[model samples]
Target chain A: MSSSSQINKRRTKPAEVRIDELMSAAQTLFLEKGVEATTISEIIARAGVAKGTFYHYFESKQHIIEALKKQYIEFFIGVLDNAVRQCAADDWVSQFKVWIATNVQTYLETYPVHDIVFGVHHHERKNSEKNMMLEQLLQILVGGEQAGIWSLGQARLTALLIYCGVHGVADEAIANQLENTADFSEQIALQYLKMLGHGELNK
Target chain B: MSSSSQINKRRTKPAEVRIDELMSAAQTLFLEKGVEATTISEIIARAGVAKGTFYHYFESKQHIIEALKKQYIEFFIGVLDNAVRQCAADDWVSQFKVWIATNVQTYLETYPVHDIVFGVHHHERKNSEKNMMLEQLLQILVGGEQAGIWSLGQARLTALLIYCGVHGVADEAIANQLENTADFSEQIALQYLKMLGHGELNK
Candidate 1:
């Protein structure tokens, strides 16, 4: 690698800084006015970066999306893994409930902007990141089963079911489906936690 | 009203019949030609309906979607109610499993077109039908609680959990998110049944 390239990368104020600024600007503009409406020129203008810098960082909107999606998925996986890590020593079922609750909080907390990540956003927007996170959840469930904590015959399927309610509620929240959003999500998540923890819902 | 109008009303097929025909045509077109690529004219042509007749029966693609959604939710509710009725006298949990397995078959065999119902096509659609069915599920759950058949403290939330998993599996299946579709869903439902039936993952 060139010394100048390494030096610039380490500098973090000029070249590296501009990329972050551009990404933030693009995300803000894209969220405020959808992907179709936002343009590279506008994103560059917002970031106060020259057009060349934008090109240096991202070749096209598609390229920007690729970068953004990678980052977004990485962030999502981190959140889930963090949840998993928090309950590493607990009963698998209890830990599973905690994981589910985190997903709900992830949705409610993310709200309008971050909600897209919670849905069936299998678009180019989400791919490997989602699959990896899903696999991690499966691993948790499988661990539960192997330890005899969870007696599910199908770990993957169980993971899907266990995660399903959380996903649906989150999706509903994302879609603004409930008449009673606050109460409904709380009730839904609580119920799911109970059901997943115990076969019967008692929360 | 004229005699012709009276005759037409009597001779008119159930809105459901036309709706099914429309759905059949639409699904075929949607698969052969993507959802966005397919045109209203193509749908009408496939349905053998006139331009005005299409409007008479439905306002737009969204309207057709509305009708299809109502039917889908109703069908699911009908299945659940039937399951509850059959198992109301038996173990509520077992009955629920049988009902889910039955629906899983139905999902694979019959309504392979449930992607739209699962919130993927939300631009012109609303979540009202989905919630309405949820309310119905809650009613049955309330009955189970009253009779001490089910121990869900918050029935609505509990129902949300079960529904999210099973329904979400079907959603994934319809959304083509799973491999080995048939085995995947039923296995999960049964695992869920065991988990819900007995507190532990074990029987």
Candidate 2:
């Protein structure tokens, strides 16, 4: 083996690390200049990788965007998952409250990335990616139903209302420059809980 | 007076009629073939207007789209206004229900145009047009609160929740090909009414 080849091997990163670095760099650029203004060459330069390395993982700018989308979804869901874990296993009401609060807080803090990933596809008549978030939210609704905390005649629709309401209201809060996410979250949770026939929780 | 000048006077239409013709043609083409596929030439030909006539009214395809967006907002709000008129002034509950129902129904019927105009601009951080819809909804919410029909602590947030939830779920309904919009509308209204501390309305 040549001496230079050995040096290059020592500098090489794991495939997962390389992909993450590329995605991080792309995300920064997308947030800074937006997707339309960003390019593959800039992404490679920021990641300190060869042009071939980018093509090895991502076919084009859109592929990196797809990867960023998946990562955003996972990151969003993970925040809710961790928040829900803080409650007792059978305490569905607390779990639901935590889910709503964490959802608003996380979305408020990370909306630039959220906008970058979700901006272009609002016109799609149907979106399978939305269903992933819906399915996660459905688990909470179903759990509350089974626990006798709430009775849901149409759980999927109910989930859609709550999930969308949470997302939509956060956007409104951001638009209005809302100061206290915690206070706002509590208010939103009370209203949703009221819809679930748990108005007493507002007390 | 020349014979050609007199002949042209009879052939030329008033500005209002010409603008309407162009918009009608654009809406039809946008619905049938999507905004991306439709062309200005096709719009002019369909409207039976000369190229100069088209240019006189709109600067470009995007200009026409902006005009159509204004028309669509007016049409949408007009439907809700008419629906609310069916209820008496003091009957805010019924007014609210009609607002929600008509919003869902009209959106379901007219989503193609909605997607066409709104699809491209969803990423914008602040949209005054969306705020207009929210403002209309806030009147129902605040009116209900003032009339002792319901008590709302955060009326604007509630409006945001209702507006966003309604829009998001309608998108879901269209995606799922929901057949009976009436049943879905009633179910949605019940949940929202309950959130307004009107749980007895569900019975």
Candidate 3:
């Protein structure tokens, strides 16, 4: 109700905007200088935020890295989810193809950020991001199985195989600086469809 | 030779034996305390060697890690190679089965060392070890294709998928601590065989 309090409210940005600014600043610095060489001071300066504001949001460089990781996963899953939803609910084949194609394309576009966020956790044996991604792929696999589009002896195992297979090949594509990801993604989808006992679909 | 030279030669171990002793010591300490917590002094002490002797072989902790990594890959490839050789040369299917099963089993048994040595390079976008392992798997794939056991549209891509898929799943198995790896290994081999367009082999 005070005049000073009213002025502070007008100056302060919303919490979400503030958080996004900090993460964006950190990501840009991480990409440019490598995460190890980047500093909290550099991030806050880039965001044009007070030192207190940076500390209030993130405890350390490592904490912001975790937040960035969570943000990256949400964005990644959202992109894939939106792409998959474009297919009809019962059109599992199309749904899966879109998922594969979108996954490869999105990851290829975003892997520099992905590497920065996920670099330290690369050797972590247990990962929630991996699980979340697997869960997304699993829904498609289970749906196809229920529709009798394909049969699976082990749905989770098969999902793991396809999910991991797709991710692995994408890493190869990225390493090779592959340019024709559209064609490459299609080939991957078809090959995996064959693995799922749907080679007839390809023919 | 002089008397001191004769005594020094008699007192010293062979180069291979000394290198193995140093590497084994470093591996044990790395596994026990983690690579970061371990020190060169500890490695030399564990090997019952003097500081000079340690530096005579390795310049630093990182240097020894590099040596251990090389040693690990050679041992890993050697084990897989030996297992594949046990199968009939013309039996591409069995060669592949053994390769997958042995890859899973050996990686399961030795993953601690594998993680220790390869952990630092986890985020490296390009890797020689990956290529080397892929080359080993590619041989079976190419053999199978030549024999008409199965066909591939992209042999390297297929090989990358299978190699990374098997590795990723094995990592999952390790995280879950699944005990029946023999059955688990068989299942993986069958699934990948299916991926290679030979699912009928399972029946």
* Candidate 2 accuracy as TM-score: 0.89
Assess the local accuracy of residue B45 in candidate 2 as a C-alpha lDDT between 0 and 100: 97
Ten residues in sequence with the least summed lDDT for candidate 3 chain A: A194-203
Residue by residue across A1-203, what tens digits does model 1's lDDT show? 67887787765556657877888888888778877788999999999978998998788986777666666767766786787688756577656665666666665665444533333343332345546756877876667657755344555556667566666667655566543354554555444344345433222
Query: What is the per-residue lDDT of model 3 for residues B1-203, given as tens digits with 9 covering 90 to 100?
Result: 57775677677776668889999999999999999999888999999988998888889998999999998899999999999999999999999989998999899999999988888876676888888999999999999988888788899889888888899899999999877788887888887788787645434
Alpha-carbon TM-score of each model against the true structure: 0.74, 0.89, 0.92
Docking quality level of the chain pair in candidate 2: medium
- What is the C-alpha DockQ of each candidate? 0.32, 0.64, 0.69
Where does candidate 1 stray beyond 4 Å? A1-4, A7-16, A83-98, A116-127, A138-152, A172-203, B1-4, B9-24, B75-91, B110-112, B116-126, B139-147, B171-186, B194-203
In candidate 1, the residue pairs with backbone N, CA or C atoms under 3 Å apart (3 or more residues apart, or in different chains) clash, namely A151-B201, A165-B164, A199-B196, A201-B152
- Quote fnat for model 1: 0.44
Q: Is candidate 1 or candidate 2 better by DockQ?
A: 2
Candidate 2 vs 3: which has more lDDT: 3
Ten-residue region with minimum lDDT total, candidate 3 chain B: B194-203
- Tens digit per residue, CA lDDT, model 2, A1-203: 67875676688876778899999999999989989999999999999999999999999888889899899999888888888998998988888889988988898899999888888788665766678878877898899888778778788888889988998888877777777899889998988888887754334
Clashing pairs in 2: none
